[model samples]
Target chain A: MTTTTTTRAAAGSGSGSGKSARGVAPSGKPFVTFEQANRRLKWALLAPALGFVGLMIAFPLAFTINLSLTDAFGAVNAGSSYVGLQNFADALTDTRRFWPAVGRTVAFTLGAVVLETVLGLALAMLMRKAFRGMEIVRTILMVPLLATPVAIGILWMLILDPTNGIANHLLGFVGVPPQEFLGSVSQSLPTLMLIDVWQWTPMMTVLLLAGLTTLPEEPEEAARVDGANAWQRFVHIILPMLRTTILTALVLRGVDALKTFDLIYATKGPGGGSDFEAETLNVYAYGLTFDYQEYGLASAVLVLFTLFIVAVVVVLRRRTERSAS
Target chain B: MTQAIRPRRVLELSRRSFGVLAAASVLAACSRGPQTASPDAPLRVLAINHVWTQAISRYLPELEERIGRRVTMRMLTADQLTSSFNVKLNASATDIDVMTIRPLQDQMLFARNGWIADLTDRVEGDADYRWTDFQDAPRERSVTAGAAVSVPVVTERPALYYRKDLLEDFGGAPATLDDMLDIALELQRRSEGFFGFVGRGQRSGAVTQWSSFLYSFGGDFTVDGRSGIGSPEAIAAYQYYGRLLHDAGPPGATNMSLEQAMPIFAQGKAAMYVDADAIYSNFLDDSISTVTDTVGFAPFPAGQAGSVPHNIPSWSLAVNEFSLLRDDSWEFVRWASSPEMVARLQSEGIPGARQSVWDDPATLASFPADLAEAMRVNAANGVGHDRPEVMQVGRARDIVGRPLVSGIVGEDVASVAADADAEFNDFLVRDNRQQEF
Candidate 1:
């Protein structure tokens, strides 16, 4: 919505300015042509934003790429000589940490986003028709999203504690054995995914609900009159209309899940615990950069991670466009 | 669309812009004066938020009066402090005049990078400072490449925390690792919810605590600058630790660090726990612990080579290399780590590295009798370091800790130790090569 609105507003203003420049006369003859004036004004308005982008984003990215090609270890200001693609070659061949981190990053994002989409669609359907206490329900749903990620991690640590947590206590009533959620090496990633799903499914529901409300009721009503059941109508008419929203939500949540660091860091700490079971790419890069101070190798890993994210985003966006067409 | 101005007009405009820029520069210069440290500027000290920092904060006014300048101490967690130093020191920031540091962990890296100021003259040239008064182990750790880069402030060694009530029938805390294991296992078999033992099981966090076990088994992280973990003694130590935790520790022990494991012992759910003696106050604090009355402290139990814990300067004071107020920074360090101040602080339950302070019985009055005795014995027999001494200590710890995690999870420790040893040997070679940079 933001993207579409911004583009339309800019286009409208641009055409309006062009038309007025040629059509209207202010005072007398103009010193400069319309194109010249428009060009100057556009540059005047864009210089500050351009400067900000260059300072804040482009400079650091360029610096990181440069550093990736050098042996920039220990101190940032320390002297370093170019080492070509040695850092990249080393990171790629590292079967111990780098590859496992990449695998975990993909697994986490895929599992969390898929589960969130399915559950979010269902919840959005349930909350489609406004009912009593709907405002309270929506507000309650926002609680998990409102809390800080570190606080959420610590809260879950307490809740999922193997010995004294209420989760284990509740499980005991149903004769289920106590389970280690974030504690076990094999279960840590899956446990964190459940937490992610809990926190972000509400955001997915809210986005999909907005998309659902904008849909025309005619197709669903026609399907119902043609003897189509609720399930059939949902699978046929509603889902097809909601496709764009689903994909948009997926891209948003998928990007976030891929770069998750705070919760993992807060819960499992550096190297993502004993066995590196929960070490995603973000965590691995962070440990290298900050913990070990291997800036060159870390920069290489970050460069690769950025490319991976870009590739994922491009693919998801192309899929979204295809569905929309 | 580009328009050209006359040459004379362009020259005039350029002169006017230059005049304006110069005026603005003058005004900015006048606003803050020069970019050097002034006499009245606060002596900024970046420190960890530990009991020593808290205790010293209360007496900061004294230091300010002594230095005749305001003192500002910013406290953060250990990790946060390290991160702050890395960024600020990398940029050669001068705001941090003094900082608390972990000598064993950061001094080598800091000294190699020239991020910490050399203090050999200040420590040795001034005879009244009594630099040699610090204990041998901690004092040696203060120097890197024959230069004193930091001063040991707080010293630590592991303590055996056990339930006096639980071990009463067993006569007391176990004197050997084998006896402790048996008692812990028997206790576990006797109860359902109670764990027999609890300690750090997280890979990196557990390394320092596990160092005692390694040394007690007559093993070291390295032997003659090569990997030592694959040796029989080291492998046996690994297997023993793995079995101890796997058989008697709580389920999901691999996830427990000091923070997580400490609570189990504090809550009276575990029979025995081992961790830094510096944190003994936590168990005694009624607000956070339930077994304060029944808690007993003992030296690290004997192993194949008898009891040998790690004696380390867990926290120290150092001057930033880029600090403008070098003399003032030295003065602050001199005052904070002096024999008089060490005795005063140690008397208040904060441990110090001064041997004279440790020798005095009055300073130990604040600590529990058994705990004080345990700390003394451990200090006497302790090794100098708890982890491998290297520039990239974090990476080294990660490699050394893998086998420890395998042991805790009941995996085959021998195979894991061999793999980790090979990896560590390769890492050491690369690490030495990187040191040339």
Candidate 2:
């Protein structure tokens, strides 16, 4: 029904645009000659490109949504019947792993994005003044972003290795006990969030920096000239202008946090994930599809996950647009 | 449009005609495609891990040639083998022919679900297929639902490897469970920086190794394959394991696994470990192991089940139910399991799995003379117990491995054992069974 309405609106607007050109000289001007055929030709030229995009993106999404509706277990084709809402029901009610996975996904996204946004904002502000070796500092900051995630995970794995690792050895000299950095249930998730922050804060910082650089200086300088303190200037003058970018960074990092997989999986072996403490929603879905061969459940989880992301995005975008205005 | 009003145009194109032309061309290409690599064409068979590839390639290179097809080999990760392309193999029509499976996947899930093709009749009928060489235990473990599921590819059992130097300093390597206890105690008492033993006490596969001790102590996961790991023997195993950890093993061995143990043993920080012999190369390689010469192998401590070394599983080569090259795949399976291939590979100094090859003079000669003696002792006892998987064993592995890790970290023997056993029968079998439905 919505599709029909959308198509009607599209056609109405399209033909309305064409109608303006229907009469050769609507204004009865001597020099003007507009033709509907030329407008039709322009639309003809646009259709193939638009059709190509619709086929490439929209078709696969439609197919995925279709598959998501079927009860498709791995390697089972005949039994893939249309089980419309069963998969969604199962995801919401899955007692053992799925619900816990959703909880963890929320925690991970909130923990990572909140911490990263704050830290990134601080780092961006601190580095904005460009005091010393600024170019070199910026160059070094990109290293974490450039390194391969799995390799970074393994590198951390060795350093945080409990017995023979340098991390423990260094701690040993200080009379601090050797800690199970990635191995303990208590520490695993936070450790992963730490790794995420390390690798990605630079990205957030760069974004905020771009926003800060583009920020109007007149207000901040006006507050300063009026004898307003540095902190007051930041709060009243600087912060109001930075809300859109800050929220943009949060939503971007929030999405990334929910999908974080490589570092967690690489650092901890399958099923051995920090006492199952690190099993986030993405990891749960991955295990279902790849580890357990439950594609139906994985698709359901994905559908639900996509819905959650879209909800968060909608909420954040509204705030961003409000702040931008 | 030509204004002829001709029936010829309808015959030439008319969307249906174009579709027919396109489909015919597709069918022609598909028939000649690699997926259609007949018993006469080169069959692209995928093997999981390098071990499966080595074991299957042992016999496939020659056998497939004899079967009028050349079997091309591809190594896949175990995750890849279990999940993705096999579904596409039939529908999407890909090139993968035969693939690898394991007890974790093969037993009923592959056969009952018909993910793997039925080759029992074909495998039994093949002149080259040998059913007698493998002992009854391996065979029973290999088959599923009265049908052969896979050709047993890589088989292994764990052995207790220790530093000869650490043991000699502590009075000698353990010959019995009591001796192990005494050594662990004394080592804890004497060593300033040394740890007594290192094992996989982590939540994953480490829990399985810990269970081997419990099972060997006459505990069972289930009676008649039902949940029963809550017995007194299980308690005893857990208690003894906890005491051993508290009194002797490394401080955080509770979370240690192959990733940690291998490197620690290699660096001479860990004194003893019970793990796969496949990991021997990392410990015995002089370039890696600082204590290479000082390392020695021993029989794992005996429990009530006697000193049957616990073999979980490696990987196995199986013909896919959808596999096009049945005869060729069977030939490859047959060649991989034969005594000759085992002996030949052993001679080449690859330490993975080929039981018969250990007795080969050349293979024994390649090992350091002392380690060779140890290898002989291990070859006698080191095919560990078959994995405790039945169906949906992945869940069971997680459930049991978790409590066992909890047992390692702090719980008393009987309590943790009872907790584990109770959880297994209730949470895993009973709850999970209803849950799976």
Candidate 3:
């Protein structure tokens, strides 16, 4: 314990002074310098992680950028000539499929994330106190999360099938007309978003529940002593304390919602629907790559999509930091 | 003290032992030969999930005996096969020795890309192959640019499948498009919860089914290498198709592909379904279908022109260009396409491309007589290509199919057709430019 405290103090002082000096051990031997040792240890721990991340993320990003400038398409090994920004220009100018896909992507992400966050917060608040069958309720909440996305899509397909599905059969019991759920162009995207919310709301609930557990009871006690109502206490104290956690959840869910492919692909296929009504940017880019083999154009769309995601994250992070301060 | 000393000595000994074991395993792994197949090695074949391909898989023992090697088969859906083969062939992967091909959809594109090996010389060299024994339409469909790239396996034509009982009540099968539409509308008006017609309605996938309608109306997607979808005949075809489906088709028809549409017809919910004849077995099997005995096949109804259906090779067997065991692959393909195998497959109720199988007494005895007659007539009058033959076939289909879906949903037919024509022309021009490069 004495050695640990001394080493921490020495490390702190070395960082503060920005100097390279040997830290004297409790035993008074000439031990390693805290400044040099800290630097070496920091790099030693981070280098492998950074290398792995670079290989996974940076190489693909750089390759996408390079491919976006060329006319590489059709056969895998087909020779390509550098076209220089033509693909980007074409993508930006493509009003037929690209712009509509962008609109759908933004709409889908916003719809799913907002619904999940609100529903999750409400459930978390309700579950804050211990009650009977709490463990069972928690386990039940985890069912959707445990099932794979493709399985969820196929399950929903059968449930929502127009003529034979149980959804319509149940509706018939109540005298409601049979509705085309995933089959209609206008209803398909919203139905998919609802499916997304159903699967992911529990995840947000768990995260917010963790945050709720860590909250200080003293603040609520003080607020109650001051004659604050339940709503007032929640809004003024609990919400502010949970801002960072909310932002973290948003970032986690937002990125995933933005690039959702498997559910849509499994349910609707390449162009999304018959009229491409449910086509989002990620689906469009995938179709360009795999279906049409327009590699250069697909790369440009992906680069643009990545930039959009990064910009959204940066803004959210800034907001989080501001709230914290 | 002795316990501590013994633990240290044991740890050191175990470390050395582990090192020796790891070295021995590495040496054993390195001594194994490469994955490339020899003449005696098992042949790996990739096939689309279809009745014909499944039949081949079931008779693998016989195939093995004929080829003198063990056989393994991987089956995938048509869509899955196309996407996977595209990636695998592009990488020149030799993991798949033989694979199924769709001549109308993939023959030109794959042959142009040099992904499939040319089988012309092999066919010429084999005396017992009897290449000419295959039907003319299927043979032509399998050949691209004067080179035989694949051997036709399952030949199918789009035919009108209707309930014989329903049709008999409605004054028998309608002979023309107008008569068919009127009969459907009248039957729909009489019956509750019964749809009159069902076909594929998904974009890009519906184009092949729509081509027969387009052809019957004296319309073509291209005429003299130019876009003809905006022609008067084409506009009429689109409007007619829209009216018929909108008035009589089941709800949510737009989401229905052949896989979905076939069930609706087989369940007796719809009176008529026009699709590839390959799915006839689905309607005939009493285990899966309710309308087995009532289902009747007819050549597609006539319009401005006489009855014109798509007699195309739906599936074929092709050799991978990059396969290390090319000779072995050829042997498998040759065996699969031989007369004896074709006849055997036909006798088992699976369709075949060989003319000999079509004429065989046992084949005729086993097959549905009326359906066989319809298939023969349609084959004689069938067009070679179902959709436009181009490298950008998928894109072309999408361009044409968008208008078709819009028409079905009651959009302005002329404007949609015009837009599709413009986009199709642009695609053709772009494709031509790439070809030149």
Among these predictions, the greatest DockQ belongs to 1
Q: Is candidate 1 or candidate 2 better by lDDT?
A: 1
Model 3 per-residue lDDT tens digits across residues B1-437: 22222222223223366557656765786464575677666788989988887888877897688768888898998878998988788877778889898887777777777888999999877889999999888897778778899999888888889999999976777778988998888777422457888888888778899899999999888988888898999888888887777788876667778766788888888888899987888998898799998999887899898898887888999998878778888988888889999898878776788988887768756668877777778878888678887777777888888888887788898998998899889988887765553
- Superior by TM-score: candidate 2 or candidate 3: 3
Model 1 has a DockQ score of 0.36
Error of 2 at B138 (Å): 2.5
Question: Which residue pairs collide in model 1, if any?
Answer: none
Candidate with the greatest lDDT versus the true structure: 1
lDDT (10s digit) by residue, model 3, range A1-325? 6546655776677666533345444455444544455565565468668757976999889988999999887764777889999999999999989999999999999999999999999999999999999999999999999999999999998788776578988988898887878878888999999999999999999999999999999999999999999999999999999999999899889998999988988778769888998999998998887778788899999999999999999999898788778
- The DockQ-based order of candidates, best leading, equals 1, 3, 2
lDDT of 3 at B341: 91
DockQ, candidate 2, comes to 0.20
Model 1 quality (TM-score): 0.92
- Candidate 1 error regions (>4 Å): A1-41, B1-33, B189-191
Candidate 1 CAPRI classification by DockQ:
acceptable
Candidates, ranked, lDDT: 1, 3, 2
- Evaluated on chain B only, candidate 1 has a TM-score of 0.93
